[model samples]
Target: MPKTALLTDLQRLVRAYGVLAGTCDHERAIVGPISREWIASEVEQSVLLSSLPAELFDTQRGKDLLAAELYSDRNVDPRSIDPDTLDLSELCRDRVINSNRIPKLEPQINCAVLVANMLLGVRLYGNHGAGVPEISHDLIVAAMLQDALEKPYVFSALSSAEYEIVDADYIKTWFGPNVAMLSYQIRDALLAFETSSDSVVSSARIANSLAAIFASRLRLTARAAGDSVVSFLGTVRRAEVVKKGLDPDSSFPERPYLARDFELAEAALQLAGVDHYALREPVENTLMIAVKDALEDETKRSRLSGRRGKAVHELHINLPVMEYYVASESSNSLETVHLASFEMMRSLEKGRRKSLSTMVAHAFRISAFAERVLGDALEPLVITLAMLHDVVEDGSAAVTGFDHSLQKIMFRFGAPIAAMVSELTDSSVKTAGAHKARMTYEQPHLISPEDQYNVNRFTELDLRPSDGRQPYTLSGIVIKLLDTVVSLEEGIRDPELMTDWWRHSGARIFWADNMRGSIVHPLIERLVIELKQSRSDPEYALKPHRVNRGRLRAGRALLETTLNHLDMYTTQNLAILSDEYQLDESQREFLIRSFNDPNITEERFSKLVLDELLTEDRLCRAMDLGRVPAKNYVTLYKKSSVPEESSDKTTLLSYRGNALRRKAIRTELGLDTPEGITALSLRHEQVLSMYDQKMSSTELKLPCDTVEMVS
Candidate 1:
């Protein structure tokens, strides 16, 4: 209803009630005592009165009400006001209505008015009155309060016991016994409607049921009271309730202003024969067509089933060549290689549908890396071992116990291949537990490993197999090293997946450290270094040393690329910058100045960029992860605190210098090679320029002649 129309109707009703009572005072329309007495005994001051115009305040009365509450007497039993005292002359008219037949009218009306006003307040503002209006119109307040003078209406989600007390007996004393009885009947009927099997049919069905019940109850109650005005008022109010029950957004009786707007908008759309769904269909169809086109593109295709077929074809094609090499170099028969390859395909076929091809490819790649890098002595053994490496952990071959699976492999591929495969497999890996604990949603870097694991579990790196469980066979270790390199390359190909893998493996902190421990073992390191020393003395220099050195160099390059993308803390503090990262005093000053420069700091960098480039030096020093070295300036600070000054060495500055010298030597060698020198030199020059941009002039000029390539 429009506000003006609603006000007019409300004023007409109040005037009719006033005429019937032989009283027409507008101020008297306020139902209760205006003094402090109407408030509860616990209320020190009436919030309603205080919020009203200041002219309404009486200093003495306000003070008394604040100090000693209006209803301070707790034991007082309220007395009912006589109908005659209200000057309700119409009640005395025998022909008009029977006063004795009427239920408690005054208090019932008062309670209804109070309820309506409270509902209005909740509708206009939120429950906490966060958006209360600056001025409330008198007619609006009066209209809301007058809604209470009719039959009781409730929209309760209360339990039966409490409903009985509040809606029945307690209300009986205030609104009179007859009104209370009527309220009980209404409450029971509504509660029954809410729980009935029919009510569960559908929302529209339930709403129809509620509307029928309310309409019938109102009609019966109005007839019983013998008042057309009462029936009229009941119809209006009950319609509001039924309207609300039909649709929450459309039925906002509390927010009448917004409710009118919603009604008008819906009506306008209805008249125009337009709907939101109709408007959205064309846009939705267009978007779906675009998506279909994008997905249908051949270049974007990635079918796991297709890849599985390709893997099978590639495995068959590569087998004859592998068999030839095995027959020529090793004592192992060609039949053994065939049996192992067959077993590998068979083992991977029953694995996870998506990962089957990937695993087969991994086996092929690992074997190839061993051949290209580790030489003929280890080649056949590593190939056979790598093919069956994951079988005991992932294949149906693994359904049997670990030792039983190894025995099966030994019977098929012989004890040597079986032993190396056993070493490659991680026996302690709890597949079910790890899968269940995996974080499948959100970016992994946002969650710390500490949130996902206990201290013992946190130290474990799933990517690098646990070192404690090994006989450290040379072939097995070399295969595993090649495995790490392949895995790192695959991970770096997709940065997001790489981050998730690091987080899932709990290797963000210990990635390089764990690889150093597993791939570059003491025996391997000593052999490689000694072999390099005796390269000119061919009598002592073993071919395996050159292979091991190549493997070490590949591993180092992979680690460097991993470090470039991983979440290693870089400090911005001047002390840490100069001390740990090896920025000289001048470089440190330049960094500090650049950061403070308004052009760089204000215009170029956002909050996210600044946060990305640097971590607090204090936080880096406070880390306590076991076996993970502290690389921040705190270590430098600790050294400075020592009694005597120890010379600083092994900083990032020296590392960059060495890296530049190596790059220069590699570039020079590429130029010296006669295989298309033009293209190679261009590529080499691009790399040299990159190095120059990354290093200081002094570091770039470091004697490249001293850095020799060990053949």
Candidate 2:
């Protein structure tokens, strides 16, 4: 057979050996305390033995000799065995038969035996050095026995007097000084790789460690970032080692090798391919490339290649050289987040209005917050949902294409994930309203009808049940709150977007209310403070004075109507004021005074209510009253605390109130002259000119009024 065909067959055998070993380990754990005879019988009946090629074994006499040597004693002394005289197939059979005899030492024993077999096979067919400058009988024996020599206690723990500690002296006596020295080097390299805090290490140590870990996880489970390091370790030549005069016991030189061993190891993974995205840490693109190269299916290989190319384009990353850089930069661990990020970039890449970088940052922030809140309970699910919350809504139709995209997601991922994405996606007003209704149902006393109307648009789902029951899962609601918090944070960072942010402030209130008793309440409280700071900034206030004034006027009208409808201010109404409205004692007192004052003008009373009494929290509370039953019974009366005041005192109070009202109006009209009259006049003229230009540029039809002339 060709060397390539031989190596391919060896890779297949090694993978089968790994899976068989892993199955034995699992069975030992579950079945409990079986005898070594049973383990040997189980190995004899397994497919691993049946699949061994006849060419690997010697003649029948050689097999009889090997069987007699192995079956003579349960524990074979290492020093008595000669590597040159042993047949490869017989040795593999002996290892497989005795692999699970020691329950506590099974994994390590299996790992060592499999790795040694892999190295020997790669050396024979792939023409690669195992780890040393050349392949030899002693090298093969040392690779197989390295783990036993390193951990002598495990071998001693076998049946009484069955095995002894296989130490360095025993190895040297059996395989000579060169194999003993090589085994020591392998052990030291493994220790350095596993124990060293420094990430940068010699390529030889990395290769050895990768082989060891890969052998250990033969079940093809997900690997961590540190363990998934797949780099090319070129073959070490005897001439190069001799020319360098390198110490045999020290670290190997930093240089490229033939990489035949790495190729063999990758081929061993062809059956159960690596899930590059399913790993818990961000894996390098080399890992993905390695998996792709190992795959025999052309379609799978091309599909993976195409997706990577698309990701490279969408992320605007230069491929080939910078793929590892991009992979290292990603903090997301879940495969869904990675896909969602790519989809988001693809959808938003055309307009580039919203920064893709910012969106990525938001996704990370939301996922992190969700992970923290959900903890280990629903961490994976919550983070996946949170990261994908905006993909369908914000995605461009031409790119993601709505239903087609969702169907693809469903097919690629599972149905539960696609369903959650659907729940999170606000694809239509009806869906948005359903989300609003769900949130409103969580806390009926906290959300306003206007917010419900604005969010839902229809009156059908507006009514909150009298029982205040929430019927939805917590994951969707938690993601909504987290998404809102991240958005509000973005708005807070950029002052220009604050105006647009406040337009959705009602939704924020609703979110906070719904999350009142949940784990995300603290986040809501923090966001509330941030919102106040942004709202109260004098600069922000000045930027949108007209819009602010209009909102204030509308609020004042609602407050007056609410006050007029109150028949009596019962204790229940007071409780509602304190709990739902969140009004302080002083604001409530002032509101009562302003409502009952017969002498105060309606306009002045409304101004007092707007400026002194009704804060945003109180306004949200007042908005909720239209749905609450307590609002229909509340009444206003003159406070007994208001004593008869002298005319001079009353006049002084009147003057102060008038001045305060005048200043409020000036601030609302942007006439306080912060930058002096000249700049203000220039700004006013610029605004009027822009308005006139806009009006004259567009043709408008005006209504003509005809009046009969009296003359």
Candidate 3:
């Protein structure tokens, strides 16, 4: 929604203070002060809640709804879920339908959408996070209050129809994350100021000024929040203020207001989503109330005494909000620009250097969209990259105490997120150059190669096999490759820089050329200027660092492709495994011969053993009968004595009836062999023999589900 619309409504709401403002007419017998009692009563009253109009309850994919809660279901008595202690899994597995948060209408409609997913039964609907649901009331409520977003019928942007089910995309469009979650900091600052006793020197006046600053920025940050709860609630007060300003008497205006905010806390609680609602309230609500109190205090302060004299003075009080405002108001005012001289160096187009930051910022949309399309697999990395690409260092602020080196910043502040950032940074880093450059002559300097580091007291660079957490798994390695590839693609659009870049940086020229195009793009231009530099300077310090990145990329891609082609399992073994499914003699021989292959990966060996885990197949029978093959039943670890056989029949395992089968399994599988025996080497026949002996001895045995050996 437009800030203008919110302002328009809030202006009208200025009359909320009419009685206090002394603007109301006393001649007409009008009511007096608005009491806290009125607000209190309405707090519990059957406040009319707005729901996504009936027409938009979701027919297509990705629509969200507050579903019917668990405790509300009567058929599932309290006793059913808890046989002994409490729920074994999702207690309300079969029950749940998404609806609005209004309990009075039909408490049954409240269903929690799992935090990670919003699709049909994608989650185990029952309580998974909060203690296993033993009782009905245990079901969590995912209080997403503003499911219904009201828009003017005339607004052409309103899709499908007015009051339709909010599309997931629209949910983000309306109430999405604004400014890398900047409000969180403003919120923290607000909360700190609000709770602090005015018994000290810090003025509530300062807090109030800060609040206006935050509110104004919040308004800008939330510009994209369409029909979103945040958009509605954030704008609500302003809207009411506007309405009061327009007419000090007209009953509360309805234009785009969030009626359910009081009950559902707007949509902030939905951050955890539906899977767990009621449980999250106390924590989320605490945060909400704190921020609310801060907002109220600031609003009051602004009303009493407002408007500061200077920009720097305004910034002096609220650093975070003030900084955002200043940077926004004028480009010259930005104080936190990262020094990424590499993006501009060696490129002929000194002109593009000046606009490089802005262009790159725009370019992020490409990576963002790509990751969005990739969905769960890549989104987190993309979000992390977006934050780092611009925030950490593009070349303005020097990292000292307040501004550590970009590498250190990425490693320290982005500790939890460094892995992801490192994947996308495109550092190229061939032969480790000097990465640090102090501010010189007040000019930003891009660190260059050949500068020797103080290696004696340095953080040693190493990735030996013993290094834990190295990218060892297939997925881990793949992530590394993809991160670099995408970054290379991001810089490939311009070609002229690729040519001129080769001459300037010398060996570093590879950086620009690699970033220019696909594995093959013939560069023809020699001196096209790179974006982001002054025209007179002609050459920037760095050329997008794109070439060495290309070589590294080409190398990694080939490795991935080669790995993909190798056969990890033989056809004969697969055939043997399939035969085990059918049973009898000829099949058993095939299985034995298949195991004779000289080259089978451990993964395949593990798979074969799993397949015969629960069968009565003959080969497994041979292994059980002590027909052990060489290299089979490999030992994993060795221990001491096994527990002595118990005589007590009352014990579940000591019932005595299945003793023979247990003993047979103990022999073939090596009873709790103090020495850990890997199941991987256990041939198909060995697994079957154990199952056969058990089946024959026990009358009350349950049917097996799969052959994978659990023990």
RMSD of each: 35.9, 32.1, 29.1
lDDT of 3 by residue, 1-711 (tens): 121222211111111111111111111001112222211111111111122222222211002121213333344432233222423124423332221121111010011111101111111222442322221111111111111112121112112233233333332333333311222333344345335422121332222223232222222111111112211221222243344432222332221221222122323223222223222332233323433332444222111111121111122222222112222122111111111111211000001111111222222333333232332233222333333443332321211001223455333322323333332233334311111000111123211111211122223433221122221122222333233333332222111121111111111212222322111111010001111132234343344432233322332332322111111111122232333233454555544443343354334534553344313344345435533221121111011212232111121111111222222333442233444224322423333443344324432212211111111
Deviating ranges (above 4 Å) for candidate 3: 1-287, 294-391, 394-711
Worst 10 residues of 1 by lDDT: 37-46
| Predicted model with the maximum TM-score | 1
Instruction: Give candidate 1 regions above 4 Å deviation.
Output: 1-331, 350-357, 374-378, 396-404, 427-471, 498-509, 515-517, 521-524, 536-613, 616-711
The better candidate by TM-score, 2 or 3, is 2
Report clash pairs, candidate 1: 112-148
lDDT (Cα, 0-100) at 109 in candidate 1? 26
What is candidate 1's lDDT per residue for 392-461, written digit by digit as tens? 6655322311122665665455444555566566646533212211211111211212232222331232
TM-score of 2: 0.28
Give TM-scores for every candidate, taking all chains together and pairing residue i with residue i.
Answer: 0.29, 0.28, 0.22
lDDT, each prediction = 0.31, 0.34, 0.24
